[model samples]
Target: MSTLHLQQLPLPDAEVYFIPHFIPAPESDVYFGRLVQEVNWQQESIKLFGRQLPMPRLTAWYGDKSYTYSGLENKPQPWLPVLQELREKVEQASGQKYNSVLLNLYRTGQDSMGWHADDELELGQQPSIASLSFGGERRFAFKHRTRKDLKPAPLILSHGSLLLMQGPTQHHWLHHVPKTARAVQPRINLTFRYVRG
Candidate 1:
């Protein structure tokens, strides 16, 4: 059995849990190296206001289904053995079956993700997302969709950490990784999801 202990984050109207050491340091280092060398990382782009701008980070999609996000339709590549291994661990911990994973490589502190919720219809209602982080620690935050009265919760996503978000979390919250001015090592993040037909 997995020895992972999940700690629930303090936030209303959302179910978020964090595991700071889902993967041990030595194992995380190996996985990080393998992913950076083996995965076909691509510099994807987004069209905003009809202007095509390259995304801040390199990404890859792997699994059994096609998914669309940020106006980009991603045709998934077959899962790598490394990815399949990781997915199994995530599934065992979260008690959710995931057929797809979206990976992001932040080459520097400047590479970031904007505020968005994983509410895509293909993911079905009450989607369970298991996010795994390997490499440098980064700041992650979640803000309420409408309740300005509540403060945004910020967190440090450390290496080998796993974050699980489920239930009504996406329905009421938006999250993002903000760019920082500090110098930091590269970070790889994988969000595992279950896509419905």
Candidate 2:
């Protein structure tokens, strides 16, 4: 049985919720671990300033529409059985039909996601993002883009847990996966989105 709740966290004028430990697939975790290994992940490069910096984290995108994306442009891989199954679970929980998902694999403690908001033109206005974490527990941080006075808060993302970013969350805040010094394990995060393209 999966236990989930919508708890509002302390934030500014905006609203945000923390859905701790939502994904209830302990057995499926192992299945996804093997799947992540078998899949062919390409190491892509990103342009920072005038120079190119190769992203440490591996990424893949899967969706219904054929649209170009910014940052690390990854070719959408055919959805595997496990991925498809996960998609259904997320869709039901969010009560929203998502046509696309961006998968990120953090191979080691060195791998990290930089500070960025998911506010994109393709995502339409006020987009809602559902992120599911599996494999390893890591610190996920969020900070207000304009409110520098607000301290950056950390949320421990565990295996089989889901974090949903909705309302004006992406518009007012920016989130990222920070690198840890402790012995870290591999983690796979799936951010489901509804792209109107």
Candidate 3:
């Protein structure tokens, strides 16, 4: 946390900060390997247009409360030591308490997340989310929900990077990780948040 140089992204109607090297490369490598092996990653299926299809990536949920996302309820799983350690580091940098984390494993460049906002009711109003990225770099972008004049903001989430989105960001903007055809290494992303019981 002491090494973080948090920089606020210059975007209207949102509170977003990015730290490219929240953790050093050596530490990140160790954490990344631990996460890939320790966390119980699962390939889930989503309902789309009345058909059940496998999600593009693997996912895992852990922490204090159950979460419902993408029309599915994810029951909480016991936190692993690695997760707890990472959580503490992230909490220090973000200066916010988080009781839960949602992890995604993009096994290939084709795995991706669609456009969406983290404005769930359980998150309450103006929720703060601390996103931690590991492994391969990926392109991330945000777009205003109803503004035509504003251009979409794009960013590259590098290994060991941290992205914090809070305040009116979820209400005003939607973000996504688009699929790429280019070959790339696997990636893992963790989004830490507090879920009100």
TM-scores for every candidate against the unseen true structure: 0.98, 0.89, 0.98
Candidate 3 lDDT, 100-166, residue by residue in tens: 9999999999999999999999998999999999999999999999999999899999999999998
lDDT of 1: 0.95
| Ten residues in sequence with the least summed lDDT for candidate 2 | 66-75
Q: When superposed on Cα atoms, how far off is each prediction in RMSD?
A: 1.1, 2.4, 1.1
Residues 1-197, candidate 1: write the lDDT tens digits.
24578899989999999999999999999999999999999999999899999999999999999999999999999999999999989998988899999999999999999999999999998999999999999999999999999989999999999999998999999999999999999999999999888
In TM-score terms, candidate 2 sits at 0.89
For the record, the alpha-carbon RMSD of candidate 1 to the native fold, in angstroms, is 1.1
Per-residue lDDT for 161 in model 2? 80
Q: At residue 193, what lDDT does model 1 achieve?
A: 96
Q: In model 3, what lDDT does residue 197 have?
A: 73
lDDT per residue (tens digit) for residues 1-197 in model 2: 12358667777755566666675667647756765975566577888797888887987777775545555554566776777887888777777678888888899998999898888878887787888888878899889988878999889988888787877888888898988888888988888888775
lDDT of candidate 3?
A: 0.95
Best-to-worst order by lDDT is 1, 3, 2
